[model samples]
Target chain A: MVNREFTVENDPRILFGKRLAKIRKELGWTQEGLAIESGIARSYLSGIERGKRNIALINIYKLAQTLKIPVKELVDI
Target chain B: MVNREFTVENDPRILFGKRLAKIRKELGWTQEGLAIESGIARSYLSGIERGKRNIALINIYKLAQTLKIPVKELVDI
Candidate 1:
């Protein structure tokens, strides 16, 4: 199971990253697989999953599409 | 007019803060006034406006209530 310590209450980036990682794992996909599916750079997706990057809104939309999740699910609205 | 340079595409915290600041200005409220209305600390609200803090989701709801805006408006989805 993914760590639940990082939450939207603490840091949105971490919360997003963790949720992305969880969803990726649930789909049995690697970061590279997600990157390819989302049409984003592997390095950038890696950085995003690690909470090392500020993902753009467009990319977030792409990620939501690739992950088959709603954009609201990806963001903590 | 508030600066439109800071957007959900750049930084969510800044976007939220900017929106909050805009709404506060529209309501003719100072930071301290907003703090009193929102039941949050003036310093914390100031920090939030300056993008110096990561506000909690509960507090976001409080801010939304105080600002009379939708909670979704405070966050980028």
Candidate 2:
């Protein structure tokens, strides 16, 4: 069943979100700070953190740049 | 100026595209092979390689999986 198959670890989106949140917190930046620096909306960033949204390649570059890391680091799970 | 600034090396999309192409060729895989393996459209993969279209997070995951690499390796440029 669909419900049975849904899991945080099994879903790549959720895994990516968790990694993003962890890295952001590790860097001591708030969601607002990241949003402002990346020029992405705070709501969208929030959604991304919560695994509710998917971001594009440009955003991957922006987030990595804002976070001062490579895109690979940002996408690494 | 924006026109002067958009060099191949300076553009993250183009850099990423070049890297993708190199990695694909290193693995002896064609664009069509990647598309069919990843369930992504061949045209879209072509666009990504040409830096004409931006792909989302899920697509990144799919591409990495199809290419048999870590997401970080796939995105690294």
Candidate 3:
């Protein structure tokens, strides 16, 4: 079987996901709301928020744009 | 074919790669040198510097750490 335990608790992707979720909540936006605004699939956003998805830079930029924040804000801890 | 034209010239990944290459050059470091400093494979760094690969967040963090900059500095334009 292929190895399945790659991601650990301190993964940066997970931290980024949590930060996205926090910002979305701060703006009173739901996952669906932010997904539509950011032009990403809601399911995909959910995975990102859960730190299970390794999102691309474009999507990260889009999220920052939708949130009206700088790209560094989303990417940096 | 598996959608051969997936990447475009204006893709964010490509832009990110260019930025990484520029910073590395500003520091007068070779790709091999940056790769060793960032704890990433030289071949992989080459792909990222060329904007052909969608690098993971962990690797981005590692690059920022190696460069002695904030994660946002590496991610933001």
Query: Which candidate wins on DockQ?
Result: 2
Which residue pairs in model 3 clash with each other?
none
Cα lDDT tens digits, model 2, A1-77, are: 13333377756677788889999999999999999988899999998988877677788788888999888888887
> Each candidate's root-mean-square deviation in Å?
7.9, 3.3, 3.8
The superposed Cα distance between candidate 2 and the true structure at residue A67, in angstroms, equals 1.2
**TM-score quality measure for candidate 3:** 0.78
TM-score of chain A of each: 0.78, 0.86, 0.85
TM-score of 2: 0.89
i-RMS for every candidate = 6.9, 1.1, 1.5
**What TM-score would you report for chain A in candidate 2?**
0.86
- Kindly give the stretch of ten consecutive residues in candidate 3 chain A with the minimal lDDT sum: A1-10
- Model 3: C-alpha RMSD to truth? 3.8
Q: For model 2, report DockQ.
A: 0.73
Question: Residue B59 deviation, candidate 2, in Å?
Answer: 0.8
| lDDT for each residue of candidate 1 in B1-77, tens digit (9 for 90 to 100) | 24343455655456556777887898788899889988899988898887656565457656777877765555543
DockQ in order: 0.14, 0.73, 0.65
